[model samples]
Target: MSAIEALYIFDEHNATILEHVYRGRPPTASVLLPLYLSHPSPQPSLIYLPNTHPPTLVYSIIQDRLLFLSPSSAESEPLLALEFLHRVADALEDFLGSPLLASKIESSYDVVAQLLSEMCDGGLVSNTEPNALRDVVEAPNWVKGLLGGVGLPSSSPSLNPSSQTPFSLPRPSLPRAPSAATANPVPWRRANVRHTSNELYVDIVETLSITLAPSGRPLSALAFGTVAFTAKVSGVPDLILQLNAPGGILNTISLPVFHPCVRLGRWKEKPGELSFVPPDGRFVLAGYEADLLGDDHLASFTSTSSTSKSLASLNLPATPAVSVSLGPTGADFEVRLSISPRFQNKPSASTASSSSRGGLGSRSASAFSATGTTAHPHIEEVKVHIPLPAAVRTIADLRTSRGDAQYAPGDTGIEWRVAAKDVAALLASHHGGSVSASATLRGSVVGEEEEDEETAPSVSLEAGSRWEYDEDEGGGYQTSSSVEPAQQRNGNGKGEAEAEQRSKRRVALNRVLMPSSATVSFSVKGWLASGIKVDALMVDAKRSKGLGAGVTPYKGVKYLTVSRKGVEARC
Candidate 1:
């Protein structure tokens, strides 16, 4: 089996910024760049290069207009190589900060080399965990200047070298201490970690991707969920995370994958229970995929006794729904989006009076979080994405009851944004007691015949001897009596041609203007879709073998719900 031979970073113009060789002899950038670019625009993430002197596999990913490419000559696991490239990109971003620009890479070569060394060992994959990398990597002094430029705290602990890869910078002479790997055996976490203010945060983010039919029936629905943990606790701690869903856990979650630190035996005992000693700082604890269309919805589509299909449509979860229709003129379109907050709450007696006056009429905009707690989670970054057809020339009569919207001539579609406070208020005012923020996008398509016909009706003919009109048998005014039969036939033919053109234009506009689907993105802190809760984070005295006796750490937990490019609806 082949392994990653070399890694290359390029700018937007295909200029090589950095190249690191890992295993075998790899082709140079001059040979691979043109080969990869030859595939045409919007290239695939993975490609094969058989025409090269030696057949090579290329795995690439684009971030912030910077391209990360990895090439291998021997037969290698495609996914393994691709995953390594992704890890490199993520590690780079964590070290150099977001929007990994050409300038950042240029100035941070020392840090980049050190990180690549730690993440890969001679082309074989090594430690890529951000938290683990932090323990070994030293922070570059340039980061201090960069952080200052960004108006961040110079002493922020998160910015310390422990959060990501080690910077390849000179360090002062000091006595060496036992490393995390030698002392703890677990390579993901640092040893003897300590924090003044012990705190833990569990952020659950779910992205929704769904398609709905014209009749409001779901075609496919999926939710990708991730549990992100930021630990600031002291010493080694053992914790159990419990989660519950509307239905049984087995029926809801599928294809669940967890961090290496999690104890598989505990999860096997109780599916949603996570037991593990978390790494220092922040990391993804687990991830899972949820079939929003549950068993009940699936059962409704099949028949047990008869070989007949059920006349039922899958009702999607309370998500943003979009519908597109032709305007009265049939040469334009109207896109309407219906938004419903996934979080619902029951107002308590103490806050009922204030809640009612708070503009949350019947729906609860901010409610108790996903852990079945009283903490209210605020809705933020509510946006609806509607993809339009290429034929749309311009938009007109664009209106929204809440928020703002805009689109260009060749834009895929319009994007509508609603303020967090307004989304909460709208949700409260709705009948369902959930956040309700919908938008209406109206637009006109290109219609040349319609424009000409509109002008033709307004033009008046001159009254002359050659244009003497005749009265029809039913008292209606007809064409001029002196007009020749051939001229009249030509006139009728022109009218037919205009009508046919208008009908064809309308049909084209209708076909191209109808929106197929729309996606919703938003975030809610202190909330989770799976109703998961952190009951307690305990430092097992027997299992935990760090710190002195009589040590009590301040521990807290939080939950969050997010949908970024996950929720989609079609019509």
Candidate 2:
């Protein structure tokens, strides 16, 4: 069966446990009933579980593993409850990062969304109809974007909530000049054209379908006469007719459009050309692909998997601009990037000219108006977003020796997290000793430049690394980033991994828990074998008691170097 089925089995197990715990009396009727049944008292012995609470601890935990949890234990029918839980868990496993059985007591709305989607698709249709899926829309934006006008019948898609990211991968551009046709042609297809409600999206396929002569000379690029694409937008951009062929690709060419607002007379069209007819909406142009199949008559087709560009999503800024925190506070593993560009301090002379032009009588005030300062502030502000989680938090001074060589330092990477008891048990099981520890409030030493950039943090083994940021409650915060052009220059598909970056940042940390007194540190002499360079560093700590973290910033202070020798602050 599916994963959900297995989870249902586990749920049943939980329900059975609850049933036994709740039903304290013996299975025999005498043990259950009251002493005087003729005049039944309020506290009758017949009800198995009239007073006790259902199981409270609903979740289990394992190291770097998934957790299994039941939402409720008040199931009158324990078997039924178990079945429901298992079915829900099985369907939502793709989004959960860990194994479900080991861990328990889970709570999150993202889980609810997944369960709902699965039930709609599964046999739960009778209980939850397809129309019920419309209830998922708590927000108008989500409803409008996802559902549009089409009503879902029943099978609902699981919203991988954390699957919020729609990642893009770069690929080699298709050749402009396509290769010659083969004996049998492969199918040529077009991607779905998505358009807003009022907007029209046309797939201008086959318009430029080209097949060169036997001698490899340009044969003919399919041309279409005037095609009236009744568009919704006024300043519609020049329609881009792009083609990926054997040799090269075509830059965008303009296309004709007529809107309702414009056009004082009859719409003109080129004679002897086919007109487009959309299924329900207005159509514009038509195009299609010519596929030549098999034998190297021209080329071969092969598909390759690809990795995404490093932080490619950075380009698309939110329109109308919502503020963000790249490395917002409270994030243990953080990179605070200040991307908002600085504005011009002085206004331009446009107002000065205006002051001179308006009869010169309004001259004094004209200079101010000519300056034309924007009353509304520009959509420029620091946005700090930390995509990476705290699991990557670096711990310091973890050194190791291979053979006769001296011990060298390296950053510690946790395969996973374990409960304090579990860690102690695992350590005890290995050797003739036992150890105990608690969750920690930790800090790392990072190196920064005068400005945060590609330069990695520097560490001095001699001086103790300490770039401390201690602020009072409700204090301000700091963030930094830099410009490294060397890597951007050779973006020609090379040196991506080894590109020289001035904004290198190295962090060495010794995370000692609040209740601990021992010292912990990790360091490495050089980062050649490993391309790890710490360019920026900051010690971000505050009273982790009340509202949020408070930050203290040193205006002149830049980088922090950390190593086994200890932490050092560099001005």
TM-score for each predicted model, relative to the true structure: 0.75, 0.16
lDDT scores for all predictions?
A: 0.66, 0.24
**Superposition TM-score, candidate 1 onto the true structure:** 0.75
Winning candidate number (lDDT): 1
Which stretches of candidate 1 lie above 4 Å from their native place? 97-99, 131-138, 142-183, 302-328, 341-377, 428-449, 452-512
lDDT of 1 at 413: 78
Enumerate clash totals for all models, in the order shown.
14, 73
Supply candidate 1's per-residue lDDT for 524.
61
lDDT of 2 by residue, 389-490 (tens): 233333333221110111112323222122223322333343332111112222322222222433546432322233434376455433332324664355
